[model samples]
Target chain A: MGDALLEVKDLVVEFKTRRGALRAVDGVSFALKPGEVLGLVGESGAGKSLTGAAVIGLLEPPGHIAAGSVTLGGERIDTLPREAMRKVRGKRIGMVFQDPLTSLNPLYTVGEQLTETIRTHLPVNQAEARQRAIDLLNDVGIPAASRRLDSYPHEFSGGMRQRVVIALALAAEPEVVIADEPTTALDVSVQAQIISVLKNLCTEKGTAVILVTHDMGVIAETADRVAVMYAGRIVEIGPVRDVIKQPVHPYTMGLMGSIPDPQGGAERLVQIPGAMPRLNAIPVGCAFNPRCQMAIDRCRVERPTMRRIGATDVACHVAGPAETTP
Target chain B: MLAFLIRRVFQAVIVMLTVAFISFSLFRFVGDPISTMVGQDATIADRQAMARELGLDQPFIVQFWRFIAKAVQGEFGISYRVGRPVMDLIQERLPATLELAFCAAIFALVFGIFFGVYTALRRDSWLTKVVMTVSLIGVSLPTFLIGIGLIYLFSVELKWLPSFGRGETVKIGGWTTGFLTESGLKSLILPTITLGLFQMTLIMRLVRSEMLEVLRTDYIKFARARGLSDRAVHFGHALKNTLIPVITIMGIKLGALVAFAIITETVFQWPGVGFLFISSVQSVDVPMMASYLLLVALFFVIVNLTVDLAYFAVDPRLRISAVATRG
Candidate 1:
């Protein structure tokens, strides 16, 4: 990217357990450009969500960033003190969690939540904040925004509540938004609507977004660039279309193969054999070596670093032209 | 809201009637009121004449109906032990008992919530451990023993306060209050603490566990993520949710404080309804005992009703549901 808005370098997150220190996110790094939508796609426990939480300085206790440098607008943020970092979150970088139903405080109305957030970061009076909250709700496509301001979370349906959560996140007009599985908790019918609403609002504001999700289809629909993670490391990262059409990493290829092709007349979808290794029992060299069909002796002996191929960067020892682009 | 109130009131009426029936049967079967009324020297003819005069010779159903009617009108007849109207006696002692209970409830609620939130926030601190240990003792110790212990310390040993009685009370209109005057206020401390200790500990434990649970909820995490100050997140978001269950417990415990203040009252010899109740029991005063039971049951009904109404104030979900049903 010509000018990156946010940069995460050599980020490593570890949890202190009774057994010992267990690394959850191992040396993950990526750059997000201004106004660009960067999708982080991975299976569960793949550290996609953890990485997002780390960037915002919100890793729960016992789980901390062991070693990392996160920069926003060319200024280092990972090392900022707690109070200073709090100002950065929801002001410089907003967050949208997985479940909208639980994301909102049930005791407060949507208006109060939105306005309180707005007033927390911005230098505005209550009346002005209230007006801004109404505007934000309207921007997220909630009808009668002013009238619905007094309604509690339970009064709204799942989709409407999500819209309110998005409005609250965008109330401060943050430079970047980290949405972690925003649509996963919604209905299939409303999932697309929520994604479109999120996409349209961020796009309109020229706000950069880090969309963390496990759905490759969602990434295709919303992300400008995509990073595919496996076992807490990025297996491949590139332009969404390029990575989807020509995945070089074996893990990414297997992932793309597993998704059902709606147009193609295949009765059964391709499935990757075996399961991802647990954090405690990950193989020393290539974490995917045991399950990768093209694993060689070298692949078993040493982990591969990212090597650029075409428009994508992949981390696989056996990545070569032998496996044709599907 | 009106419908909810109406339903609650209806339920309260049923409860009161059930309690009334139980107390009625207790007075009817527990002792012979005529023998106590006439004294031991009265002949059989005198006893029969006295029974007829009091309508005790009527059918059981008719007598019970008359008792219920008189009770509704606040007439519980005369106390056999004191030779006074039971209602008048209760009314005279009512202020002392209410004042004692009210003070105890306030102490328990304020300190319990404060200590609860403090301990929950600083769970790993040494101070929290000490508070929890002390609260455990407060919970485990019996009420009368706690009262006696306080009296021995503050009254007998230190000689700082009076050991027994409501000292130098002031009468304001119909209510005789010990709230004013230095000695009267000093007299209340031991009894209040002794009565409040168990409820305070119970509320503290409840609030602490609830606060811990609320802190782990997703809404709390989301609030933190939204960059709300730690104070705002903890108190504004988490504490409000924690209080929903605490309110119910506090309401029920407050009612229990009033009904069961008999032990603390007897220990301190505070002139309250519970003391009267204890004395009436010793003398086998059926009218006083029955009326006391009815009064306690009535107090519980009012407390439970207030708690239900308070839920509507604290939680918006209930209010919305009520509106939805109405619409």
Candidate 2:
């Protein structure tokens, strides 16, 4: 926490629509420490994935970072030139896409893809790069890694292909990896396996991970800290245990309630009333005010900034004062 | 790989046989070859003797079988117009057509791919707009009209090149090639453009669209995410995927160029097989017509086989699946 490896301050992501510019990620901010796993949890369209993409400078055209800075190791990376940013991509920050099937080029062998990536970032010859690729596949727990190197993406099953993707992301041994819904497209049984492989590999390499997902259960199992986002903003962020046990923001409370309690028999899951507002139609103040169960008059009129409350930082006027938490 | 080739060859044989059958039928129904061969002075008895000698009096199936047998041996009897062996006539004309089609193909593929890739990568540039407009014009204009336009521009107005003919050709063995001499290459410019314009535009549009589609795929995005250089991403990955479908189209288009170079050849008087076929049609030369039909079918089959092999080379998925199915 003292020396954050990756720091994102006041990040703003906006898309230029025909009507006007719509803010998709509105002034979201977070910091990641080395060897730490930070989970970004939100429903679809909440800007969680956009936040991750912005950090690595991979936001698609027509969408861009409007204002704010992404700093890595005391240098502002968000403003670097295209070529320099590209070098920093797999060299400093790796990324894993959602679908394993589409992430790999079907024309090339996995070995060719992996070795090419390795050579792109590292000052290594072909032989060295291939050796490193083999080691990487082995680290990701693929069986017969050497034999499987020449196999194409279609040769592997969904789960195995994801493992290959993880290997590819970690090929350069970057300081940070942005895994956006890495396991979302996998089977339930295989999802845990991928997560465990990801967790173990990142932990072993001492690399920080920004895990963006909608599954709170995954966050509970993997993340040391968690940020709960809603309507393109972080409503609450703190250690996983503290936020899950004692959620200060009403949105976080509703999110926690929705997860069925396996131990508590015959209890219905909680459903939050109303959907998240579209980017253009977000409420005037505290974007979540329309669906908030504990919204006060101030919550609707004056947008609440994140205030330190105990160990957690929450953005809600109705939440108790900072000094009230033990 | 061997199995695939064997299957393709077998299919090619069936296609050739079918094409041969149709041409054989055309020989029987179309005007009398004896009437065209003997001129207006022959008596009824003489015409009957000639028909019998030519095996035209035999049953249709027996005549067809004889045609097939002679065709298999690269013999197509005698041409009514040329009064020489049909095979020898085609042999003399085939080289000119092959050279023309070859040059046109090179022109079309090189410029088509270049323009396609350029426009796709620079979709919003003014140059791209101009290129797209030019391609539209190329696609819509008819071949003969294009040939005449080029002839008007380069020959009529500029007086820079010859309007027709293959120019100075060098004889190498039995093959007469126009590529060796300066005027020959110069003379090829107008007809090549006329013949290749439609194909080039078709290829350009296809490559541009496929390139755009491939650029949007997740693999391309992933390639960029890996910090690959723009060259490696665009050419090495995206372009390879773009070329898969382009290869098949190129094969078909190439076959069409050779088979349907009639208008271009006629306009230029290039002495190619296409020009020969047109004259043979006018003279009702059945043997020449049948031989040309078989040759075009053979060209198509060979091109398709090459396209399939190229698919194996570029795409690992296809290659692996082919092996899997064989196993």
For residue A20, model 2's alpha carbon misses the true position, in angstroms, by 0.6
DockQ of each: 0.72, 0.82
RMSD of each: 1.9, 1.7
Candidate 2: where are CA atoms >4 Å away?
Answer: A321-326
Model 2: per-residue Cα lDDT at residue B272: 91
Model 2 has a DockQ score of: 0.82
How well is each residue in A1-326 modelled by candidate 1, as lDDT tens digits?
54999999889999999999888899898999989999999999999999999999999889999997899999999999999999998899989989999989999999999988999999999999999999999999999999999999999999999999898888888999999999999999999999999999999999999999999989999999999998999989999998898889999989999998989786788789999889988898888999999899998889899888888888987787525654
Give residue B274's lDDT in candidate 1 (0 to 100).
Answer: 99
Interface RMSD of 1: 0.8
Report every candidate's CA lDDT.
0.91, 0.92
Question: Local error of candidate 2 at B6, Å?
Answer: 2.1
* Candidate 2 interface RMSD, angstroms, 1 decimal: 0.7
Q: In candidate 1, what are the lDDT values of residues B101-141, reduced to their tens digit?
A: 99999999999999999999999999999999999999999
lDDT by residue for model 2 (A259-303), tens: 988897999888999999988999988888889877878888998
Q: Candidate 2 docking: what grade?
A: high
